[model samples]
Structures are given as C-alpha cells and as structure tokens.
Target: MKLKRTIIISIFFVLMLCGSVLASPSSNNAKRINSTYISATTEETNIRYINDKFEVAPDKQWTIKFNKEVNPLAINTENVQVLDSKGQAVNITLGLSSDGKHVSINPPASKYISGETYSLIIKKSLSNKLNETLPKEVRMKFTIMKDNSNDTGNNVNPVLYEARQGLDKIYNLVKTDKERALVSALRDGVNTKINNPSATIDVNPLKDQYGNLSSDEKSDFKNAILSNFSIGALFEIKSIFE
Candidate 1:
C-alpha cells in the first residue's frame, strides 16, 4: 500500500509540472496597451497619444510595449505599417526587442516631412509567441512638428539597409536555437564583407544553413526579404552564395 501511495504521488507531481509548462496564455495578453507606457491621454478607443500630444519629431522612432512576449516571426510589413496621407505605405523599419515584448518602429532614413501627418497601424494579425493575436487593430495618427532644425536624418544606402533588414528577418524567423546562433555569428561577418574591401565571408556555411531550413521557411524568407532586393544587390548576394 505504501508503494502504491508513492507511485500516485509521483504521478501527481509529474502532472503538476506538465501543467505549469503547458499553461494557458496569460489573461493580460489582451490586445490593449497600458496607457502608462504610452501616455495615451485621450479617451479614443483606438487612437493614442504620446506625452499628451499628437506631435512628434520628424525622425521619430516609436517604441511599443506589450504585456506578452511577441512572436518575432510575426513582425513584418503586413503586420505593422506607417501610411502617408495619400494612403501609401511609408518606408518604415520594424524591430522586435530582445525581450520580444517591445517593437520599435523607425521612420525612413530621409525622415518624415515636417508638418506632415502619418498614421501608425498595428494590425490584428500581429501575434504573440503563443499564436494569440491582438483582439483588434491599433491606429495612431501623429504629425511631425514644424521644426527643421531638429531633424537628424542621415543618408543611409537603401541597398545596404535592405540587406541588413533581411539578415535580421532570418535571425528572428529561424526556429531553432542553433539556427539563431548561426545567423547571429554570420551577421557581423556578412556586414564586414559588405562594407570592407579587404574582408571576406564563407558563403558555404550560409548556403548549407539555407538548405537546412524547411521549405515553408525558405519560401517565407525569399518572399519577405529576398524579393525586395535590387538586381545588383541580388547578384551580389547570389555571388556570395556561389
């Protein structure tokens, strides 16, 4: 009977451990952001403000914090976007923080025009690591303050920027820790090869890494990052692989 009781207790402890590991998503993972983090003074349902105002710097980079860890793979142009008044998609950069709870939306290298209004949109498709999506879409409109002197814009090479963004995408979207580490190591090597005339990187490892990715992931990588590269950039990247 003592042995039977011991066996039952062990089973109970094992179940408890499993329950904790596979627990349901947090209730706080709901679609809304805490006003304390963003300072949304207005009572608007979807519209929010920063510092009780709708005016922002021309080179503003908005940081959004969430209650749950977001899925890096889900961060993309389709999920988060900035639109000009003409309904055109602006060239914005989206970066997921190391903790995965924050996303930084960076404006174009040329910066937003002073006195122009732009809308920041976070769609419902934006999801957390558990695949729980935002309950609704989020939109915020802010105008660039009319002050040309404060503009700190830089002339970033578009091709270089796109290539770096591609590397980031691959790093984020990879599933395994081994793949992520490989990408992390390759990033600086690839950047050095691109910027320094005397530097070179072994593309065989990258080619092997790409070959190891699942077909779906490879397709996503090509569509999301590679398809946007310019012909010259594509050739350069292809040459590296060869």
Candidate 2:
C-alpha cells in the first residue's frame, strides 16, 4: 500500500507541473472560475495535513491524469517563501519533474516542525521565452500542518474568526487585513488608487461535506479576500440542504 501510494503521488506531481503554468488561458481563467481540488485519501490527507481540498503542502505528492496535453514552463522557486503566523518567511525550492507534467516543491526538512500552520506564497512568478508566462505562484492563505488544534464549536477559532472579522472590516470600509493585503499587492505605492478589474469569480456553496447551511445562509463564498468578496454574496438566500 505504501509503495502504491508513493507511485500514485509521483504521477500526480508530474501533471501538476504542466498545469501550474500561469500564462495559459485556462489558468488565467482560474483566477475567475477558480478550482477546488479535494484530496480524500489517507495519503493525500497526510500530504497537506489539512482535510479540505485544493490546499496542499510541499512535502506531499499526488497523481492526476488529464485527457489533453498541457505545455508547462519551468518556474524559479527561489522567490517562493512560506510565511508563518507572525509573517516570518522560510524559503522553498522547486523540485524538478521527471515527466513533463509533474512538479514538486521541496522545503527544508528542518522547517516541517510539529504543530504549526504556515501560509505559502510565491513572491515572483516564472515566465518562459515562448511568451508562455506561466507556472504561477501559489494561493494566499497560510497552510500549516503542525501543532495547532482543530477548531471546536465550543471554543471559537480566533484566527479564523479574526480572519473573517478582517473581511468584515473591509466590507464595512474600515481598515482590515484583507484591505491591507489586497491594496498592498495591487497598489503601486502608498496612497495610490487601484482600479478594480473584472474577472470571473468562483461562486460556490460553502457547505460542509453533508451539504448543510446554518441560519445565516445568504452569502456565497467566492474564495476571495476583502477586495473580492462582494462578487460572491447573493442578495437572496440560495440552496438549503438537509
């Protein structure tokens, strides 16, 4: 089973390399349509150290077979850094793919300490000579696998609560982490105005595995931070699953 798991994971990485290119039309649309990948197996669950789909860790690998061929470019991993909760950075590098499709990220073995969640970020993106500027950076949220306890319904998860709260601050036009990060990433400089660009936003039902929504069920999640959340919320309450 272990060998089989390793083989499957090896195959998964190759496909990801091909798909990681950011310059492709599909990838560009991912910013709009969004993709959420769910990894349910024991092997995959162990890799990301998270139960949810779409988020992953550098140490883990998986296999995905696609019908079409994708031309993916090489990415420079020197600029990729893992940011801790306090926002300190640890460096990671790109692991060469054996197949044209597979890609891997190798962080220092020492950094995989027990019991802490860390966010992954790519400071610089890779672009090849073919005008195929792709192999884009990872997403914004922190990915941690170490020592943090799962949130209990009894005791609120302050970090998630704060993260949600930060979004609220942005929605209310107050200074918030979402506003800060979005403007900081998109802005030219301090006090400079940034324009809102139209893109397809992923409007998905943020339901649990059982597909149930509590009383406050009006809003749809767009996988967006403060600057983008407005696109996801619906004026009318949508699906109600039992």
- Highest-TM-score candidate: 1
TM-score of each: 0.42, 0.32
**Candidate 2 lDDT, tens digit per residue, 68-133?**
322344444444455655777656555434454444455566644432335554432433334343
* lDDT (10s digit) by residue, model 1, range 1-48: 667544433332232122210000111112222232343332245433
Candidate 2: 10-residue stretch with minimal lDDT: 20-29
* Residue pairs with backbone overlap in model 1: none
The deviation in Å at residue 145 for candidate 2 is: 3.6
Please report, in order, the local distance difference test score of every candidate based on alpha carbons. 0.54, 0.29
